[model samples]
Target: MSEDAPTRADGDRDLFDPNYRAAVVDLLGALAYSELRAFAQLAKDSELAPTLGHTSALAILAAHELRNFKLLTDRLRALEVDSEEAMQPFVEAVDAFHARTTSSNWLEGLVKAYVGEGIAQDFYREIANYVDPDTKSLVLAVLEDQGQADFAVAAVRQAIEEDGRVAGRLALWGRRLVGEAITQAQRVGVERDALGSLLVGAPGSGGADLAELGRMFVRLTDAHTKRMERLGLSA
Candidate 1:
């Protein structure tokens, strides 16, 4: 296959299965809405920037998120799914996550942009492992860092350096963010059975078993700890 084309999984016919297709649709839908919301959140958070440089950087990240949203929607259209319809089911859950985790200050917003989004991307990437190669590629592509990680880490670490107490507060904030994130994931699993089947190895679903599901969470937790440390905060 050419580099521009989505490579099909060799002899993996699960893509044609109804259950598998539904799972992919749910995955893409959740991701598409997430990118859309990330774009909105980033733009809104830009107003909290203390400097013009920070504002411009956040605007750039927001633009990247919009582009990623387009990519996901385009893929949904390719699957003959209405992008809006696919995203609708996830709107309430995703919006609730943002609402509950609203940041009170510039630093908290930055940490949410970093730690909160980081765990989400990690979770999606883990789910990608059980999906078709084409869908997996798109998931990973849309989840790309877009310079947010380095930017947030540098800005947050600098703040912590200026005030050692900043680390303590942000550490607490990071912990809460992770907790909320896990809760959101659990909620999605409960509400989206098609999507959940992808994690539990449903018949013909091409997913992991319970043991592997447990390992996936371990991996996600480990990655989140590393991200918190990068922000100079305790996990």
Candidate 2:
């Protein structure tokens, strides 16, 4: 987390599952790290847009991610988890994932923002439900507030209307993003089994089995590809 970015402070008092405490802490920490990095990436990538309208909206959206990061970080601290320590190792994992799949242009950036943010929201929604009610409520509340996905989707749709051929490259890029996501997920499993197990076993979240998670991942990929097709972009 950036030192200058304002910390989001929420009530520390929330019911939680003691057995799954580490998983919850680590999940929030990892999620927070992703948000922080995404903001930084968007802030940089937003300038790549041709229009001030696109750049300005992305910058403002990037700022909002900081708020969510602060909220998640504060929650980690309240749980007596070391926010920095928990988030540290993941910095590389999440950052590397983004670095490897960076957008080549503004439209690529927006498409990435759309597909990436949507999947992340879905993943978090699944994870949050498995935790406790307070954590669930807080996570759900935060989920409701993310506008980046909406903005990204709209931006891409508009961009597609301007140039139809951009779809093939962007769709390919989305596939690459999905590929890296799966690779990093495997990395996460090796690095953090407990969290992975929680993801696998926590009721209906993420997966009932590895096959289920695989199925869900394929669904997300197909949805992204469909998004491309809908935009007059070829998969």
Candidate 3:
């Protein structure tokens, strides 16, 4: 904690070891896959929008996602990691999660994106702190919400203002998404221990209590529920 002493990231003197590279590569690949899938989901979800403006915005946002996907994938290739293969392992989990909680309406889609991406950003922000300086910055930089949560929140708010009746269904939809998302996240944990160890931070790293990963997940869900409430959706 002192400026005089060099900060210790892990027990190893070199933090950029093979395990770290694997973790970094997988992490980047995961994000690239996320962007690609979000592009498709956004396009589909945008169809539920009654307004042309909202729908067009979704298309624009989807473009942003593809652009990001390109950047991340390029970085993965530069690192000599097979971007597709790195992303393959967790694809089923993510795909199943999205499918199980597919949104039925515009507000539902926005709520899911806003709520889901918010929680994911929290996890990524924590991960940004766990890695070495370059990777920490990279992680922080990739934690994107500009084209997703921010846009979705405004659209949802405008929709609610225009049609107050949507509150009931969107609220229920939000809750269901929160539930399904955590379910998928738990499944991801079982399947991807690296994430739990990294995003959750290592057990002894002077970071957060890795043992409290479950509690942290619960806390994120709780906060997301509060966001729903703030958006006029009951928990």
Top lDDT hit: 1
User: Candidate 1 residues 86-183, lDDT tens each?
Assistant: 99988898898899999999999999989888888888988888887778888999998879999999999999889999999899999999988877
lDDT of 3: 0.69
Please say which candidate is ahead in lDDT: 1 or 2.
1
Deviation of model 2 at 154, angstroms: 2.8
After TM-score superposition, the amount by which residue 72's alpha carbon in candidate 3 deviates from its true location, in angstroms, is 1.5
Residue 221 deviation, candidate 3, in Å?
Answer: 2.2
Candidate 3 per-residue lDDT over residues 1-235, each given as its tens digit: 2232223463342344555566666667666777678778888988887889888888888787778788777766666667898888769877887888777767777887778656655655555566667556656666655567667667777778988988777888877777777776566545666655565455444345656666677777788877786677787
RMSD of each: 2.8, 5.6, 5.6
Error of 2 at 78 (Å): 1.1
Pull out the clashing pairs in model 3: none
TM, every model: 0.93, 0.81, 0.82
Model 3 scores worst on lDDT over the 10 consecutive residues at 1-10
Worst 10 residues of 2 by lDDT: 5-14
